[model samples]
Target: MSRYAEYRALAQSLGVDAVALVPGPNFVRLMKQDFHSHERPLLLVIPAAGPVAAIVPNLELSSFAKLGFEGEVFDWMDQSGYAGAFAALARHIPLGSLAVEGQVMRVFVHHALATAFPGLKIVDAEREISGLRLRKTAEEVAALEGAIRISELALAEVLDDVRIGMTETQIEGHLIQAMFRHGASELAFGPIVAAGENSALPHAHARDVPVQPGDALLFDWGARHGGFCADITRTVFVGHASDEAQAVYETVLQANLKGHEVTRAGITAHDVDDAVTGVLEASVFADRIRTKTGHGLGREVHEAPYIMRGNRQLLEPGMVFTNEPGLYCIGGFGVRIEDDMLVTQDGCRSLTTFPKGLRILG
Candidate 1:
């Protein structure tokens, strides 16, 4: 069996003539190379039972050559545009119905394909295509561990210097620098460094507001290393915590622990989420629940096998996801504790080791 066998089978299973890949997680996984998907168009087409083919930009030919691709290459120039390449690919493979990544492929590329192959059927196979990466490999898990290590080290360094008067944006600056200093190739996403009531917003952005004595400081950040991503969120108190704040923090902490306790291979994603959310719903702050239990994590921060209600996807060994349970009171404050979880044969293991104990940072 060839390396393309799985994708070929996927194409056949999807009832499409071929599966088209753009420069994204799936493409990178197969090609083992990264290409920027900018104004130029780069496409790889894998038919169900034939040699694969590709449409490469003239400038990327040298880079694309490194892949040792066993197929015909239709290269086009900038001045001439990519229409010719697409046209040539259309003639070579003559695809009738194709599967594409709906979220990754751009509209311009879609138009180019449509124009080149008139009456071509393009099916959005986002779920099926991305689902291939749902279960992580041992190598992928190592890469994610490296990313989480860098992120945790950066967080520890940032927390050591955090004082009561520093602004949220200032703290954010410290975090970015610390991640790179700790050897992060890239940020998984923009770090969230919200303070006080701003932390109440699940996806709050850092501001210039200074940290206050009795305020909650939330940091939701991750680092990307070796093509994998690590997402971890920790909420801390600035100085002294109010009685209400401690209660809320403890409630969210137990809910996060419940997720860990219930996750294992053979369990449904819905079961893990139901067990986690059940704790929160049974709490006095049940009305404060704002988001789902968590999401799948890997090459992309968000992917398949989403951990939430109504999702029946079974949790399997080697699958990685975020066990994040948060409670937010719009104008008051929020408490969220997030951890990267790897599902094992017997149970799940937390990839994030940063302490979850409520600590007073000054």
Candidate 2:
């Protein structure tokens, strides 16, 4: 079978004539190359039972040629625009109904296709298309491990340097530099270095506010290496911890541990989240719960098989996801412990090894 067999099968299953791809995780996975998605448009079309085709930018022809793609290339120039190229592709393949990555493709490209192939049917297959990456291969797991190793090293360095009174943004600067120094190709996302009450916000941004004694310092960050991503979050207390802070921290920690204990192949995603969230729901801080248990993690930080209530997707060996359980009290503080988990035959293994026990920092 050709490499396009799976995609063609997916297209046929989705009841679409072809599947269209833009520059994103799915694109990079199949082509083994990355491209910038700017003003220019680049597209690849795979029909259910025929040869594939592409509309390439004139400038990218040389780079696209390296992929050894067995298809017709309809190249277009900047001055002339991509309409002609899309028009040519329309004539070549004559697609009736097509599947597309709704999250990645831009409106301009959709409009261009609609204009070129008038009366064409475009179906948003974001979930079906991205679901292909739900499971990790051995090689992909190695890349994720490399990313997590670099992130953990950087976090350790930042914690050692974190003293009372340092601004949140200052600490963020230390983190970004340390990730590169420890050998990271790129950041998975902007690092979150919220301090004190700011930590109460699940996705808080670092600010100029100085860290104070008896404050919660939260760091949610990761590094991207070898086309894979690592997402880990650790919350530490600066100086002394209040009685309420310690209670909340311990509660969140237990909930995180529960996620590790219940995950395994053959279990449903809902089961894991229910077990993890149950611990928090039974706690005195139950009202403090602000988010779901976690999300699937891989080439993109968030993907399919979301760990939450109402999702019945079964966990399978080789699937990886984040086991993050957090509790937030708006205007007071928050505590969250996140770890990347790989589902195995018997159970799950945590990819994050940084200590989870409560620690007091200077």
Candidate 3:
């Protein structure tokens, strides 16, 4: 909720003295083009060596004021010519060194800001800001908890509807309906209803096959509510899973559980990954591992501190993410076991609790 504070901390890290923000989301949030307000445009002014001030467009004056700002305000008017907006904004402070979110900010905005401070030092500020938001706050974790509840309920209903001869598309419809019924405003991502061979794709979102008896069904889905998201994946086998299918399923489940055992406060994401990697190597399905051990899931479905090779971010309390270990065999059946987790002060707690043991669906 406080993207400003995160940027302020970044400004401090970059040796800046103060910061400023210009409203940049007039086209999206105000225009109804996008539903997300967090992605709306905003300008951050950081004074690395001294103090900071704020300058905003006339149209954004009230919006900025609503932010309950405590610093100086330089309102820019644009009723006249092309330079009015830029000039008015530029009139706020004498430029020295400024950092902007180059990765997330639009190119046009970057160009305009650069033009206004041609003589001042302009630097890419993405890493600085992203580092500040790597940790989750209490309020943020609460929102994610709600999202997880809605999502798990949806999953339970989806599992209940599983029957032989149903197409993947039909399963997706039931999932969407369950999500809405459980309180999701919309899907956090497309509900993956892959059956048998489709499950081998890992990220297959298209649903186009009938679910037959004794086939692997992977449902990778999430739900969005109150501006938060939940991510979870679960795989099941229809009645009479082949020996290969059962073996892969059990191996994936063991890898998932092994990885979960190592997730705790103070543990690095790489540590958790290595724990699972060890179990995967020990198991016969080691060669079948096809994806990362897990990933951080909050705010955006995929965010900071991802569980991948060489990521050294320590698992901190209040952090929420996913532990989804998957195994894929080309042309053969694959399996994946996933669940949403919240990092507690001591260890991690699962948010989604639908039965994960191998289920033979018919």
Reference-based TM-score, model 2 = 0.99
Cα TM-score of candidate 1: 0.99
Please give the distance, in angstroms, between residue 63's alpha carbon in candidate 2 and its true position after superposition: 1.1
For TM-score, candidate 1 versus 3, the one ahead is: 1
292-341: candidate 2 lDDT, tens digit per residue: 99998889988877999999999999899999999999999999999999
lDDT of 1 by residue, 264-349 (tens): 99999999999999999999999999999999999999887799999999999999999999999998998899999999999999
> lDDT scores for all predictions?
0.94, 0.94, 0.70
Candidate 1: regions farther than 4 A off: none
Q: Per-residue CA lDDT of candidate 3, range 168-195, in tens?
A: 9988999889999999987888878888
Badly placed stretches (over 4 Å) of model 3 are 1-6, 16-65, 69-84, 119-124
The clash numbers for all candidates, in the given order, read 0, 0, 10
lDDT at 212, model 3 = 84
How do all models score by TM-score? 0.99, 0.99, 0.82
Query: Cα lDDT for residue 120, model 2?
Result: 96
